[model samples]
Target: MNKSTYITAENPMSATFRYLAISIMFMFVGFLFGKLFVPASLVYAANIFVVILIVGLLIFSLMSRKNVIPTSFSMNFVYLFTFVDGILMYPILTYYLYDLGTSLFINIVLSTCVIFAVFAFISHKKPAGYFIGLGNILLTSLMVLLAMTIVNIFFNAPVFNILVSAFGIILFSAYILYDVSTLKHYIESGRITCKNDLSIHVLNLYLDFVNILLDLLRIVSDLKD
Candidate 1:
C-alpha cells in the first residue's frame, strides 16, 4: 500500500491510521469554523437539532446494509459527527481563550497529542485485550462521573470540582488505551474489516483525546486561578 492512500482491508493498520487522521481533521475543521466563521450562538441554537442528527445518523449508519463501511454514508456521517462535536465545544474553548488566552489552548493541544502518543505507544507494546477487560468498569466510571457533574451543578464545591477534573483525566487516559487495545482485537479477529468499524474506533479515540484535553485545560486553569 502506498503511504498516502485510502485504507483497504488489506492493510488494516494503515486503514486505522487513516480513519483516525480523518477523525482529527474533521474535529479541527469544526473547531476552526466555530472559532472563526460564526458566533457560538448559531451552534448553540442548533445544538438540540445537531444532537438529534448525530444520533439519527449513528443509528442509521449502524443499521444500514452499507454499514460495512468504505461506503460513503458511513465515512460522511463520521465526519459530520465529529464536526458537530467540535462546534459544540466552541463556547467552552472560546471562554477559555478569553480567560486564559491562546497559550493555554496551545499547551492543551500539545499536551493532548503527547498524552495520546504515550498511551498509544504503551497500548501497542502491550498484549492485545490488555484493556479490553476493563470495558464494563470504564462505562461505570463514566456514568458515575456524569452523575457527579450533574450534582455539582447545585453543590459547586471547589474540592469536588478539582476531583472531577482529575477523574476526567484518568478516565479518558484509560479510555485511549482501551480503545487502542480494542482496535487491535478488531483488526486481528477480522471483526471490523470495513470503514465503519474503523470509523467507530476512530470516534472513540477522538472523543477520548478531546475529553483529555478539556480536562487538562481545566486543571491548568484551576491551578492558575
Candidate 2:
C-alpha cells in the first residue's frame, strides 16, 4: 500500500522529536542531581517526576483534538510510563517475593515470554491495529508489574530485588527494539496523523530510555550489594 494512505491531519514526528530532546535534557539533569545528592533519593525523586510527566502528557492529549503527534514522541511517552511503573513499583513489590529467591526469575521469564508471544501473534496485523494492540499489552503488563511491586515493599527481600532488576533490563531492552521498529514502520508507512499521535510517539521514546535507566540502576544497585 502507498505510504500516504496512513497520513492523518496530524503530523507527530516533529513534536515527538522535540519531546524526546526535552526528556533527554531532563535525564541529564536528574542524573546530575543524583550524583550530588543521595542516589536513592534521586530515584524516588525521578519517580515523582515521571508521574507528573504522565499527567502532563495526558492533559496535553485531552486538550488536543487531533492525535497527530510523532511516533517518536508517543514512543517516548510510553517509555516514561514504563519507567514509572517498573522502576517505581517493581523492586518494592519483589522485595517480598525475594523470599521466593531465584523463583522470582521465573516471573521474569514468564512475563517476557508472554509479552513477546503476544507481539509475535499480532505483528502481522495492520500497522494501526498492530500498534494499538501492542500498546495495550504493554500497558497491561505494567499493571501486573505494579501490583507485584506494591506487594514487595511490605515484604522486602534482597534476592528477589536482584531478579527483578535483571529481568527488567532484558525485558526493557526487548521493548526498545520493539518500539523503535514500530516507530520506523509508522513513520515510513505514514501512519502518523496528528498531535495526539505525536504525543504517543514521544511517550514511547521516553518509556524506552527511562526503562533502560531503571534497568541500569537495578544492575548497579545489585552489584553494590
Candidate 3:
C-alpha cells in the first residue's frame, strides 16, 4: 500500500522483481479475460482505447516522475496500465493461438521468457555504467527505427517489414539491458528510495519484454509465410 510495504534496503531487487512478476500475472489475466469475454468485433475500439490509455499513462508518468503523485497511486496505475496492455494484446494472442496453434504459441511465450531472463542476467552481471553509457546510442537507434517504421507504412513492403521487425527485436533487447542496468544502478545509489520510483522501471521492462515477443512473432510468421 505504501513504499515501506514493498521496498526495503535489504532486498530491493527482490521486491522490484516480485512486483514485476505480479504485474505480468495481471497481464495474463487480462489477456484471458479479453480472449474469452470480449468480442473480436471490438478489436478496433480496443486499439483506440489502448492508444488513449498509453497517452494518459505517459502524462501520469511524467507527473509521477516529478514527485507530484503518491507512490501508492502510481503503483496502482502500473497495474491498471499493464492490464489494459494485456487486453490490447488479445488480437495478437488470438492470431498466434488460433491461427498459429497452441504449440507454437507456447513456444513463443517460452522463448520470450528465456530471452528476457538472459538479458536480465547479463545486465545484472555487468557494471551499471556499461549499460548506462548505451543510453544515447540506443535512443538514437530507436528514433531511426521509428522513422523507418513510418516510411514502411506508406510503402508496406514485405521485406521492409521483416527488416523492421528484426531491428525492433535487437533494439528492444538492448533496451532490456539498459533498463535493468539503470534500475540496478538506481537501487544501489539510493535513487529508488520509494515504491513510486519502481513504477517506471516496471513499465519499461514490461514494454521491452512485450515488444521483443511481438517482434519475434512477426519474424516467425513472416518466415512461415
Q: Evaluate candidate 1 by giving its C-alpha RMSD to the native, one decimal.
A: 6.0
Tens-digit lDDT track of model 2 for 29-127: 543443454344444345335334333433333222133543334444544544444443333323323433455544543554455445433443435
State each model's CA lDDT, in order. 0.68, 0.47, 0.72
Task: Report the lDDT tens digits of candidate 3 across residue range 1-225.
Answer: 555544554466676678888888888988988888888876545423432433343344334334465533476777887788788777666665665678997898899999999999999898865698888787777767666766765676778878987897898788888888988888778677677777778877776777677767767776777
Give the candidate order by descending lDDT: 3, 1, 2
Give me the displacement of residue 211 in model 3, in angstroms. 0.3
Per-prediction TM-score, please?
Answer: 0.78, 0.48, 0.82
The top-ranked prediction according to lDDT is: 3
Q: Which candidate gets the maximum TM-score versus the true structure? A: 3
Write the residue-wise lDDT of candidate 1 on 60-123 in tens digits.
Answer: 3233212354432366677887788777666666666666779867888888899998998899
lDDT of 3 at 47: 27
Better of 1 and 3 by lDDT: 3
Better of 1 and 2 by lDDT: 1
Poorest 10 consecutive residues by lDDT, candidate 2:
57-66
Clashing pairs in 1: none
TM-score of 1: 0.78
